[model samples]
Each structure stands twice: as structure tokens, then as C-alpha cells.
Target: MTFNAVTFTVFLVLIAVVTVMGFVASRWRRAKQADRLDEWALGGRTFGPFVTWFLLGGDLYSAYTLIAVPAAIFSMGAFGFYAVPNAIVLYALGFLFLPKLVSLAHKKGYVTLTDFVNDRFGSKALSLAITITGLLATLPYLALQLVGLEVVFGALGIGGSGSWFVRDLPLLIAFGVLAAYTYSAGLRAPALIAFVKDGLTYLVVIAAVIWVPIKLGGFGEIFRKGGAALAGKTTSTLDPAIAVNPSVYLTLALGSGMAFFLYPHAITGVFASRGAKTVRRNMSVLPIYTVLLGFVALLGMMALAMGVKPHDGNPQYAVPQLLSAVFPPWLTGVAYAAIAMSALVPAAIMAIAAGNLVSRNLYRQYRTKPVSAKSETLVSKVVSVLVKVGALVFVLTLDAKFALNFQLLGGIWILQTLPTVLFGLFTKRFADRRALLAGLLVSVVYGTWAAYQVKSATGGPFGGSTAKPFFLDSPIYIAISALALNFAVVVLGSVLARALGAHPRAAGVAEEPVAASN
Candidate 1:
């Protein structure tokens, strides 16, 4: 099918308008001091409830959610439902948990989760480890966002021709715009653009929900046709862990529930709120998006009706392909643009968050002296560009399937930090810094090894998925399991350290703020 050139043009015009709006965001929240890193990176920590809600939603749903959920359903059938529940669980957990994190952040003037890690563990090295791990994990996450944008462009016929260079033009342009505003306005850009992105995303999601059914007969019909084929043809269904294992499901739900906010970029959104109250209020309301997610996940079922298969070269293309077939050229163009916009906001946030880690944690650690605020800010901006470039390499070199799976692998890797970042927020129980380090190392190896063991098809003991269950057969989130191992090691190590009389740091660090929102 062909695109509605006129509609596509109008969509581009709207995105460009929003892009410029983001560029002016710094001025919107400008304080008297132009050079303040706090204002630049944390949006002056002054966003009210509405902005915080949209910003957090935009950050969370993102291009990944927009594209990946439906793609999962299109490719993997019932397994794809995990993403929808994961999102709901995340929002629900945030509602119950975020206010405290936000309160502590506000009180402490914290700009990143690493700050909290440093304060809680009272260990610079552990914080530095978190900082590095977060940057590494998020870089590919940023690349996946770009891949989302590229899929939309390829679907909508946005570029000159179908060549790789042409298809990728939108990604390059999106990256440039994101980098420019993020450099100039920092968190303000994403904070402001969140409104546009969330607004468009909500509208597009609702429209697709309504339109897809009408276009494809109905939801029941679509599901009936699709579910039957999927049940038999899928790689494996017997292994509960790999397919629907209860333990795997519960672990994934709980692990992601715990780790979602622990992600540096995710916490960055919380840090930008005006106060803890705003976070709590927003949390109460954000579950409304869970409704949208239900609809969004259904798009996968719709894709099945349309016979949307993962492209040989690009798994990311499934959603866009499904949408293009289900909608008129014009509406499809709008949907693609909306998804592209979704990619831009989160990519910018991840890049900035990652850059901040490098500049503040790693670079400053090695420097002769503390870097000036201006230098800190400048270094962040420079590395943001470099990080984006590195992500571009991932996009170019890795197959889309490999990239997506590897990203999930990265999540498993980063989840190791949950104990140090999230649990450490409330108490100092496992007070040994060395224990934290050991836990982190254990988590990394265990999670990666588990992911390596998972296979596409289920079979003999060794032949099954990377997460070869000493027990189950399902798509248990590898990252979540890794986190458990990380925490367990920390517990064992702390026990040993205490018994061995390893001198504790003497309550050695500056006191951590007692609240999540400062």
C-alpha cells in the first residue's frame, strides 16, 4: 500500500513544530542563573503534577513500547502479553513507591539515581559502578529507540526511496534534533516534549484500537484466526517458565516491578518533579495508561489477522507494517510520526542520563579535582553525542532481533543494581560496600550466562533457552533473575564481612536524605 503523501507531510510538519517547541524548553523553566547544572539537568525540579504525569508516561512507554509490544504479539503470540502486564505492574508499583524516592531526591538535590546510590551505600566506587552500568545499559536502549524511529520511517514512506540510506534518514534527523535540544535544554526538552509525545501517542493508540477492529472485521474474529495458528506453530508451549511458567511470570513481574524505577533514566524522570507530592499525585493517576496498554497490546492480535510476520531482516517492522495495512495512507502516516516522536523523547533522555553518568561518576573520579559545574555540564553534552554515535553503530551492525534480545539481556545486567539503588533507599541493612561490589559482579555473570543458555526452541535439557531452568520453560525475564542472584550475593557477602570483622566504613559517608523525594 502507498502512503498519503499529503498526510505524511502534515505529520512531519507537526513533529517539526514540536521539535522546535522542545528547543525553547530551557527558556520556559529558566531560572535566574543560566549556568546551573541542576536547572539544566533536572528541569529545576519544578514540574507540577500534569507535566510530571505526561513526562513519566512518555519516558516509560516510548518508542520501544509503541513498537515492541505489538511486534511481540505479532511474532510470539501469548508471550507478548508479558509487556502489557509488565507496564501495568510498573505503574502500580510506582504509585505505591515513587513518592518516597521523589521526596528524597528533592531533599538531596539529586539529579541521578547514582547520587542516591552514593548516599545510601556511602561508597563512591559502588556509585561509580552503578553509573557505568547504567550508561552501558541505556546506550543500547537509546539505539532501540532509534530503531523504532527507523521502522516508522520505513513504514510511512517518509524518505526519498526504499534504500537503506533513505530509510535511515529519519533516524539521523531525529537523532540530530534530539541531541541539539538535549544539549541546549537538557531535561527540559524531554519534559516539555513529553506533552506532545504523550498526547499524540494516546490519540494514535486509541485511534488504532478503534480502527483496527473496524478494518479487520472485529477483535474476536482476529483473535480467533490468530490464536489458533500461534498455539500450534509456536516454538514451545510446554515449558511453563519459557511459555507461561508461574514462577517465571511472578519473578518477572516482581523483578521488573522493583527494577523499573531503579533505572537511572527512569529515576531521572522522578528527579525532575517539582516535589514528592507531584510524584505521588501523578502516580495515582498514571495507571490510566494501563488502559491504553491493553489496547496497544491488542494491536499484536490485529497484526496476526493481517498476517504481519517479523521481517526477515527487521523484527521491529512488524507493528508499522500491521498499522500500514490496517489504516488509510494518511492515518498510518500520522501513527508512524507519533511513534517516531515517542522514540525521540526517550532516546534524548537516555542519552543525557548516560552522559551525566560518564561525566559525573567516571570522569570526575579520575580527574585531579572536582570538575566545575560548567565543565560537568559541557562534558555531559559532549558525551551525549558520542554515546548516540556508539548506539548508531549498534543499529547498523546488529540484526534487529539480536539488538532487541541483547537489550533485554542488558536489562538483566542492570537489574543487579536494584539492591544497591532501590532497597538501599530505605535502610543500610546490608551495609558492606564490598558486598555490594561482589553482588554486582555475580549478577552480571549469572544473568549473562542465563541469557546465553536460552534458545529459540524448547527441547532437551541443554537445548532449551538461555535461562535453562534447572526448573522451568518460559520467557521469565532474565534480568529479573539476575537481580535476585545479585541481592543474594550481597547478603552472603555482608554476612561474611561482618563475621570477618571487615571494618565498616564507620558510618563513614555523608548522611543520605531520608526521603525518596527531597
Candidate 2:
């Protein structure tokens, strides 16, 4: 693919503007004690409705929505619509549980999900387990953001066919800019940039939705052409005649919905809000983004209508290629910039959330001496930069499909913690740390084996996250099965530990009542 100077210039300008906004966000709601972990990592726990809405929207919708979701639809047809209900179920689950989580975190001054688990279970080891699981889970998610940016870069013809170093140079530069702003501004960086990321996304997507269909004749013609183009492709069984396997779709929705809040980045966003009501209100409004996602997914079929196959067989570039071919060079630039910024915002937040897990849960727990809150914040900022660098390495060295597959694997691993974190919130019976550990171990081992057995549509083993366990005809999401195994282990382990005379430990700190408003 040849580079487009006009598109590249427009992309650079938008990136420059967003970069400036990221730095300025440090002062958006400047805390007197800005070095405090809560202030640095959670925007002083003071984000109100509007800010919270955008921040959570940015955090959840993600670069994956912009790139991978479309790629999935483009490659797999109707199967990719799984993202739609997955998101809907996520918000529904959030409405039921996020308020309680926000209140609990606020009451306990928790900085990460691990903090809540640590305090609730009164076990540092359990906290460490959650922290490790979070970091591992988040790495691939962060890498997915880089993959999204790479697709945008490829669209602009910046790095599609070059030497390895040349191909990755733009990604490195983008990661550097992201790390610098996030290190300085912390959670506020993404919070501020979410506005631009989402605004440009809405504008570009709405424009494409209207323009692309008309250019392709109409929706009727677009689908007809798309179906014809996808004809005889085994993976392209997209229409009703093909009939999606219900088991795969249902489990994918339920499992992904349950794992949504378990993500450290998602929890970090929830923790940033000012009050329980802020979380609940945001949950109600976040589905607007999901509606946009449904439209975004359609861009795949539109790409098929325009006969836009991605360069180098990378389906992730399908939407970008479609936009570039269909829109003018300048509008295509704006669209690519939106896609790039979508990657940047979430990558920044995920690094911060993972950094918090390391600094607060791992470092603070294992350190020989007491650490100051200021130092903890400082360490986290530094770690955030390193986390981004690590993800950058993953992006450069591995296949982009690995990042997507690992993200699904990540969902499996993160869900294993639910027996401890989510269930522990409601019941004291399963508070035994050993039982939680047993459940986590069982789930991880089983999920990994299941993932390993699945072959990728593109190639290789462990290429996908769905499996047909016990030789069932319909495939089920590995995470759902893993979660079931995790729950069983927790139940049985708890009973055995009780028989062995294990006792629940009390949370050392006092829980205060949280205010109901911002």
C-alpha cells in the first residue's frame, strides 16, 4: 500500500492536538495532593457524571471496538455480532453490581480491584494472586490497542510494507507519546482525551454509516454485494441462511459480560467516579456506545461491498482500508485519527491500571519497609511507562492475532478471580483464601488447555478461545466453562476447608460510609 501524504498530515495534526490535551488534563481537576495514589490514579475520585460517562465510554468501547470488532465481523460474518450482546449484557451487569463496587471501593479507599479483594479476604497472598492475574490479563488488552493503532498507521500507508524497524517506528513513536502524557497526567490524561476520541469517533462513524451505504447503492445492495463477495468462504457464513451456533454466541455474551468489570482498567474507571450514583448513571448511558458499536461492526460488510480486502491478509486493516477507499483523503485521515486515539486512550488507562496493581498490591505488600503514599504514586507512574513499553514489545514481536487471542485468554484468567472478588462481596462463606486459590488454579489450567486445543481460523493451535468440550457439536466460550469450573472448585474447596477448621479473617481496616452524591 502506498502512503498518502494528505491523510498522514491530517492524522498528525489531530494526534498533536490530542497530545496537548493529554498534558493539560493534569490541571483539569488538579488535586492539592496530586502525588497521592488516589489523586494520581483515580482523578481524585472526583469525576462527575459527564466526565465519568465519557471516561467509562472510552475505557469500554476501546480500540478493539474500532479495529478488532470490525475485523471479526469482516472475517467471520454473523458470528462477530456477538460483540453487540456482549456489550449490552456488560452494562446490564454493571447496573446491578457497579454501584455496590463503587461504594465499597470508596468506603475502603481502594485503588484497584486487588485492593478490594485483599481487604475483603484479609489475605495478602490472595491480593497477590489477583494482582498477577490482572497484570497478565491486561498485557494483551494493551497490546490490542497497539494493534488498533498499527491498523490506522497501515491505513495512512505509514508502515504497511517495510523493514521490521521501519514498519514499527510509527507505533513506537505513538507509544512514547502515550507513555509521557500518562506518566505526567495519570488517569486524567485518558479522561480528558476520551472526549476527543469519542467525539471524532461519533462523527466519523455517523458519516460512514450514511455515506458508505449510499455509495454502495443502498443497504440492500450493500448486503447483496457483501454476501456475494463472501460466497463460498467457509468463515463467511454471515447471513440467516447460515444459522449461527447458539451455544457459542450465548456463552460468549454471558462470559464476556461477567468478565467486563473484572478487567483492571474497567475497575479503575469505576473507581474514578465521585459517587455510587455516578457509576449507576454512567451504566445507564454507556449503551449509547454499544449502539455505535453495532454500526461499527457493519463497516465490515461495507468493506466487502467496496471490495476492500486488507493488505497482507490482515483483517484488522479491513475497516481502515474501506474508509480510505470510500472517503476523501482528508475525512479518511480524520477517521484514522479517531481510530488511533481510541487505541491511545485505552492503552494509557490499561497501563495505569496494571501499574496500580503492581505498585499497590504487589510492591506495597512485599516491600520490607513501609512506603509513603507519594512514593507509591511515583512508582506507579514509572511502572505505567514500563508497562506500555512491554506491550509495545509484544506488538512488535508477535502476530497481531496472538494479541486478540490472548485478550480472550485474558478474559478467561480474569474471570477466575470472580469467585474471590465478586462472590466474596456478597457472601462470607467463600472468604477462605485457599479456596479462592484452588478455584483460580483450576480455572487457569483448564482454560489454558481448552484454549490450546482450539485452532485458529487463520492458522495454528491456541488461535481461538472457543472450544467444543466433551465433543459437543456447538462450541462454547472457554471462559464460561472456566468460570463454571472455578465456581465448583470454590464451593467444594470452601466446604472442605471448613471441615478442616479453617476460619475467616477480619478485614483490618474500618469501612466508612460513602456519600451518595458527587
**Per-residue lDDT over 1-518 for candidate 2, one digit per residue giving the tens place of the 0 to 100 score:** 66888888998999999999999998888988987998999999999999999998899888778887887777777678888999999999888777887887887799998877766666776777788899999999999999888877777777766698887889888988999999999999999999999999999999999999888899999889888877745653122322367887889888888898889999999999998898988889889888899999999989877888688887888998888888899999899899988999889999999889888987887899999998899889999999898888988888876787788789889988877765656664544677788889889999999888765442564676777776466678888888888888878877787787764443222232233442
Off by over 4 Å in 2: 161-163, 234-243, 455-461, 471-473, 506-518
Q: If candidate 2 were superposed on the true structure by all CA atoms, what would the RMSD be?
A: 2.8
For residue 503, give model 2's deviation from the true position in Å: 2.7
Q: Which model scores highest in TM-score?
A: 2
Question: Cα lDDT of model 2 overall?
Answer: 0.84
Residue lDDT tens for model 1, 1-518: 24567657867887888788888886896987656667777777888898888888888888888787776676667776776667767777777667877787777666777877776667777877888778767876888887787677666666636787775676777777888888888888888888887888788888888887887788888898778756655454245445556656666666666667767788888888888789878878888887887788788778777777655534467778777777776676677778877888888888878877777677765798867888887887888888888888788677665566666666776778867755565554545777888889878887767765654343322232235334445455566656667778877877888788766563222454475433
Clash count, predicted structure 1: 31
Worst 10 residues of 1 by lDDT: 456-465
Model 1 spans with C-alpha error above 4 angstroms: 1-3, 158-167, 231-241, 309-315, 455-466, 469-475, 506-512, 515-518
